[model samples]
Target: MDTRELEGFLAQHAPFDSLDAKMLRSVATAATVITFPRGEQILDAFTDPTNAVFIILSGRVDIWNDADRLREAADESLSAGELFGFSAMLTERSVGPRAVAATPVTIARVPAAAVAPVFASRPGARFLAETLLSTRHQALAAPAYSSVEELITTAPLTVEPTTPVSEVARLMTERDSRYAVVPGPDHTFGMVTDSILRRRVLVEGLPPATPAREIMQPATATAVVGESAQEAQITLLDHGSDFLVVTDRAGELRGVVAPRDFAVSPSTAGVALNEQLRRAGTAEELDTLARQAPKMLADVLGRGLPSGRVIAVYSSIVDTIVRRAIQLTFQRHPDLSTEAFTWLALGSNGRREAVLSSDVDSAVAFVDGTPPDEITRYRAVFAEVDEMLVGAGLMSDDHGASARRTLFARTNADWRAQATRWLAAPTDGNGAMMTSLLVDGRPVHGDTGLPEVARVFSDLRRHPGTMRLLLQESLSSRARLHSMRQVLSRRNDTFDVKTYALVPVVNIGRWAALSVGSAALPTTERLRVAAGSAMLPRSQASTLIEVFETLQRLRLRYQLLQIREGIRPSDVLVLDRLSAIDRTVIAQAVREVSSIQRRMANVSNYVPTADWSSTDGL
Candidate 1:
């Protein structure tokens, strides 16, 4: 191949693509073209190190973790433009996996010494390190249970809207039930419970002649009988309701299922934990409950609950802990009014996608024109909240940039100014970072100033320049894949599921949502909106959503394992620990992310003329 052809090939791939012109030319010159016949053994870990990186030009190679058990063990394959053998060169240790040409292959043999200068550069170094060491694991399959009907113990007590409150109470008492479903017009049902009887009737001095409907609270949610218990649990949790009316296909109320029914025992840690969190009055008491979180997670997973539902439950618990912390903070500083500011959960927590491994990312947006003295007191309140949260085992943001910090905590006017500055210079690194955080902001406590925040983001979407900048930032991280060869060459045991798989999907979904001015916060919801609006093709969006969910499930499962082993949960996963099915799922998910990235590139076309040069480099 000519120098231009070689350079073009290098520029088309990663690490090399990040290199400057001079470095690219040097790499192209130093690379030697080589070919191997089909079935040729390329490298064996038992043999001496190759001392070179092999970048495929054509054909294929099969990599196996165990050469002797190649067919039975987890393996991967590599195609054109993929590099391998670098880990052996860098570590100077015998590689762990064996690679063989799966088809007649052509490759460029780049000596490690020749690429030394490029590796010395920061981008190249980080890329190579990530490629070599990062690994991930998958969750164990949960037991499959059939339906919510199995959890229902008794028939629902139904009553008419005009039934006397006295008669309804008498029937509930006779049935030993705390709740009764009052049928409403148009096939709806209202919930009348003991709590309502106490608070709305006796406490308010309501007459016994008051109708049942007058004291009933409308059911916010319901579940079909044949649905899985996990699905029912999710429905109940999503609506923040203690109980869900179970219905038949005809929509007739059959029974009720509460969150407690899913627990293995009456005092199952998962059920008891929530009660403990609600009653927790001190940081120490909350911390004690927090320690039970891992056990609760394990219990839920053991019951074969769906991963999405598991995350929802876990997030609910975390939310309770955080809100309780805020309540405690207020008790410590009675002068500070919660109505003066809004506490926002940012990042994964904000999106309601948090797992055991998640850290706290939060901010406070105060009401306009708060007194300076009160602002100072509010800062102290926020700081106390953060301290209590951290003490209860929630990891704080890396820079401690929560509501306690000036950067995150700001008045309504200050936030508007910040948003304007960010939109005006969207490509500025700091501005871009802040914009990403703002996109995921969710109000957890106090007055929700989210409408004002949403308006700012919507305005950014209205501007062409802002859309272009967002597209650029979202495309900043490409999905990383290791060919069979690359996987075999590495000594590291863990993979970074977040950086390689999860983050790319998140960024793509975020950009797509913002491009269409979507108000969706969760990644899956954003993709759904994008697809519905034709911002993303339905087929592609569906695939991307499925892939994102799969990655999340795997990450949650891995974190559960870490917690069981008495280690701090994190994103790094052990590939060898995964089942064959999981490995296959992960490989397919990686490819799906790459495909989405390419599709997104084709769709983003509104680049600013002045930034065209920078865009070309990316």
Candidate 2:
């Protein structure tokens, strides 16, 4: 490849985005361009990996493992700006061993060595590396967060502009609504609210037969169907309306955006965080906003979200809030670039299922460069903000997210090396440690490009022995599915309930997903996403998730009972307070545990050797 081509290619990756003219020229002056053809492997597991990560100049790369060629174990293709060998680079112990190639054209390899030193001196380099190290299969331009379709309150009240006022009131009452839409023949809408009923018809001395449009508010607030709920919030706030009519791209009315509905909706916390980020000027302000997250979920639950989905939604919001807070921290400290760094959220926070009183697990990710001096300064800033977040009500993780836990964060190269060692030779004792965090981790915040880090983590989990170990360790802790007699009635006397029962299912689903590289944020989600080729089918997976949810809700309800009674509750429970139906559900959940345990026993050869390698753990 020529100089012009090399510069163009490197320009497309991160770090280059924020590089000043002088730095850009410096990068251009010291880049090497390599070429590959279709089907040629650019890298593999056996290469003597270096600290430098690879950036695809162009074309597609297939990630396959001949050791286990099953569709369950391999990804068919990766495209432009997607990175490979990043895990190899990040892991200080063992380099990542994934292949790359040309779809039909040439590709380029930019050594982290050349720009790495310069990058280390620059905050942008740390940001770039952090982005890559986030999950080990880290990429160059991964999506910022897991994006999902927006849900809206689509079924709304409707009426014609010519409707009578008294009839409008009847329509509202019949539909159990306080507002209704009155659309003109041309499709323009006006709103008829409960307030209008009293003022326009009753107080104004207008006849009950007056046309609806006459009594309705003429100034209508509207939002497009795809517009974010935050936009809807602002529209309502700006127009002094309780709801905004949501229209489609073609301008047809799609639905109504109610303030209550938008505020209480699940998973759209990103919309709110995005808005907050746009207006944030300081990290302290962002920290203040994060404290409001739990209450928001508590309110959503009050609005009728099921206990399980409520936890998922609630945790999702908190993750987004904390993520934005970190982003704001980076913005405030321009000396610390997010581009070279990957931020890891740990423990309950990592899982996206935090309760109102939960702790945070987090670390800073950087790239391994020629000089150790490269990331030291950014590390100082990372230390400062890490402590700041703790003081802000996110308790420190019990598992020690503190730096005392041996530089728990590393560059893409360092992390990949460690993940490789844990995967290839994971001891029975600590096998669950690194991979546990990986399963709950969603890039709730920070560089999405680091999915490669996760890939590496998951790939290592494919080790059959680790599966056997996890299966054994987890099932040993399972509560009896059903006692010969009553179960929870004898809780502390029977099972600890919280750690012994729930954690097994949690860890089981987590290990299963890690073994297959499922990119799901929660254990329930992991089970669903991994059902395709897992030993369990979709129905079994659903049942497991259902059981897990039942257990969690039971725990939550017990807590609520304690709070209500001023009992100063613990997770231990009494089955007596539960409805007959709930008791039956718990019994069924216990039965599911039994089934999982039996299956685990078979997989583990519980009778003897307990061989965990079923098709190389795929």
Candidate 3:
């Protein structure tokens, strides 16, 4: 093989593609070409152990089920531009699927040592880590269940929206399934669960012949194939749903997983902890359950879960505790329930990214037409609710963002009016900060249908003034560094990770998401959607997402360590204390943020139009 041609081929594949010219040449020089005839096995579990990475250059390769060549695992085909044998070579283990050439195949065999330079590069290392370690990447030790794919026990029972309720129920019964997916024409879907049947049909005296669409409930929670099981568990815990409708990468129906699946695996104690939170009868009991969360966080982190997933698991459990506290409050004063309201988790909690030391940022959105007296009573109830949460170890927002503050709690109509005022007058100082926080608000409890404020923010995509304000805010928070190169600690060798690193990415992601009219709440999802819509370059978005994860993991690990040492957990980390590798990682992540901010400065001038057609010149 021509060395230059091999270099070109290697330059097109990821991890390898990120290699510099000199590194690429060295890798190309070290690579050797090997050919296999059709029906020949390349690597087998117990024979022909893989010693190098194999990139298919031509023709096809088939990877069979682990330890056996009897059948192929679902969708396990490798064509040109795909690679295999890397996992075996990286882990230095002769274990994995038997790879067989489906046709006359030419492969570029690159020894693991040849690609060591690629592994040292940021993008290359990230790709390797994600591909090899998976998302359970060593922030945690070993989770009981890693991905949602692990919990899938059966294929989804899909039905047309117009299918008769009786027929749907019969199909579910025949399959012994608890839910049936109702796919819509617009690539959306809903579910008709057994619980829906019992409550909406039987109890409501609806006819069995009613169209499934009439009784189908909107998807309460969903997960994509390959999503972490801990993430799926969080969805279940927060939504109080029986099952999560699983979808493939293309948003096609895949399968469903339930809480019962977690019950069986019992790897982490999250599900059990949530159950205790749910069953707690008093504030004291709830506080006790809440105190156990740190240990659970440590266990999750020990199991190799990433920081984002770890925070999500902890935050979801906290959501349950908050809801239970509200329930306990309601039990004491049932009259407060007479006024319909939605409890909104704002800021970090709303984004499901809170840490052990994070403050409670909350608000209350009452339904229109509630009496003035009842509104006052609702405020008092939330005050007690705040006290309970504080007793449970969460700190109240020192800025008075909690629902207990009258300024933060308002009727749906009032909230909408405030949002309009904020958007129209983007220069208002208080409104600008509030708008930033309010965009992250999500319903964690109560009616869960506060649409007024959402409607106001929905127009933000076309609101240039507000979009500029948000964009400016996103760029304002800079990573603490000396001359924009060396990471700098501010006080006593300590740096506020949340303030300097995490919050800037969060702000940038939120702005990017809103600019693209994306409704995604999580920062990662926001970055992803923004990239998909061309609002930001895909590679840049991926970099920011990686940086966010890196900093988040650092903060969570430091706080957990503090708690273990009997010190109060805080976002401020002592830079002098981090390991050499960790300190270097922080410096690299900080530089990445600096680079993104510089790039985003150009985007401040571009604006979305009424139709949301522009990509903000990103």
Candidate 4:
């Protein structure tokens, strides 16, 4: 385009529009037009730290941080008139993002010398400074400690339970330590620390020869060796202790971690909330914990943890709270045998995708044919547990679909019968809902009888018609994508992301897994399993997983904001509230979901062989 045309385009776009005619002409005159074909690398930060500012004059360019492995979807596509490559110029730092021509693109490259003159102008300087600051803020939000192993210290001081208190103190003194680990009667590690010696030994005038086990705190906190530092931190604080016993995958004790090791980080409110729930011997304590959950959620989100990992941590915390409530309920009703029944977390909890505002979707599955009196006692226990959960901020399902309802608290035989009925008449509304719920059911407590449930699910997989019906149902919802004209015309609107993005991805993943008789409940795992078994294309699976994680992060940020503002969280996200980068990511994710649906439509036609029982494929 000519200089006049370039000036007109610059006048219509952002910060350039704020420039006076003199400054605008300077920018337009200095702009050199460059063209890149589709699939061409435009710029790499590592090799090309171009000081020139890039404005997309036509077509599209995708900008992404190549170094950001945690943020797989941290990409933004800019079309005509959008500006990029300004941050490097303003901050005087190396360009951190790589750019590529997503489509055949023409870009205006204005020299750093010319752009420097614009920065002297007040409006232009303010805009550049704000953009630079925003970029820095986002970079800071990325995860600091990738894994908990980073925090694991060397082996902690160990002592036998038979060791005398005097001996334990001497060992601690020699080691220059404040704590020691002792073997518990329950075969778990117990903690002996200076506090116990000061409070019990000295204050109570106990003999120095008393067994260390008598005063050591029972082992209540532990984390897998591979868990994230954030998870370990939450666990330690949740148990109201500074220390945690780190264990390997085999449950063998590895080492101990303490808050001081990590510089004595401030106690997170979420951890305190978990602690309260665990120690909640009474209903009132649960109520208090529930009320504090929103703030705790706000705190965790504020810490800038990755959204997917944050959800996992929050889900685990919720699980612990729910499980504790069940334990407390069993204590109240001693007649109930915890082994006879299992508590099943359904919906988001079952999939481990739960967010701040997720509702309780759970049920109870008991062994077949318990005595009537014992059944009565089990019903009471379920009722109490449900009440506790509701009180702890997990509102029950509106349709009375929880363990508190008799419909869900069924025997193994009953669930099998229900599964059979649902498969037999898969198109029915109730059947579809039940099928969706049962597909995601995960045992959270007690004897789950999962093998029998898995057997029934495998049997359902034998019916090709059932798989066809589920695939159709899964694709019923279309992705929420606006036409180009519609997107350009709309201003400041919000939509329910759950309906448009999350549900469709979840349904498709579930369909893919069940078609191949894979029992992986989590959506990401389901996609991985489907890809591994060649049921779905690996490339498509990877794209779908990326889209799913992006949508999840967006939804979580929106919900956490709502929680922080004292409003109940929801899936609706205001487009105006998101950063320009985030808006582009969301749009890309939605398009990807649409692509996955089309692929699912093609895959739905294939029917597995009658003898295809491939549980081990994943």
TM values, all candidates = 0.63, 0.50, 0.68, 0.59
lDDT by residue for model 3 (282-388), tens: 89988987887887788777757666778888888878888888898889996567338888888888888888888888988888887778788888888899889
Which model is ahead, 1 or 2, in terms of lDDT?
1
Task: Encode model 4's per-residue lDDT on 1-618: one tens digit a residue.
Answer: 999999999999777888879989988999999999998977765355568888999999887754444246536777998877665554344535677898999989998998766654535644543443232223311224445565554567899998999999999887666789986654488999988999888999899999988898877788887787777866665454757888778767778876443321222224434444666767776666666655445545666767776787677677777878888778877766788987888888888899876887887788899765666667767877888877777767657568767777788888888778788887764777678787788777776446345557665666767766777788998787553455788743776788788888898788777877778877998988877443467787888898899889878878878877878788777777889998888888888889878866654455353322243331
Candidate 1 to truth, TM: 0.63
The sequence of per-residue lDDT tens digits that candidate 2 reaches over residues 7-119 is 66666666565665676666666655566777676776434645655666667777753323323544546677655554344332232345756375455455665655443
Question: After superposition, which runs of candidate 2 have C-alpha atoms over 4 Å from their true positions?
Answer: 1-288, 327-334, 370-380, 402-405, 460-462, 474-476, 480-497, 532-534, 537-539, 557-584, 606-618
For each candidate in turn, give its C-alpha RMSD to the true structure in angstroms.
Answer: 26.2, 29.6, 18.0, 20.2
How much lDDT does each candidate structure score? 0.74, 0.58, 0.75, 0.72
Cα distance off (Å), candidate 2, residue 98: 63
Pitting candidate 1 against candidate 4, the one with the higher TM-score is 1
lDDT of 1 by residue, 528-577 (tens): 87774334677877898999889999899888888889899998778899
Q: How would you order the candidates by lDDT, starting with the best?
A: 3, 1, 4, 2
- Give me the candidate number with maximum TM-score: 3
Off by over 4 Å in 4: 1-146, 150-227, 231-253, 256-270, 328-334, 337-339, 372-377, 420-429, 448-451, 459-461, 481-492, 532-535, 579-581, 606-618
Residue 366 in candidate 1 has what lDDT? 86
Cα lDDT for residue 15, candidate 1 = 81
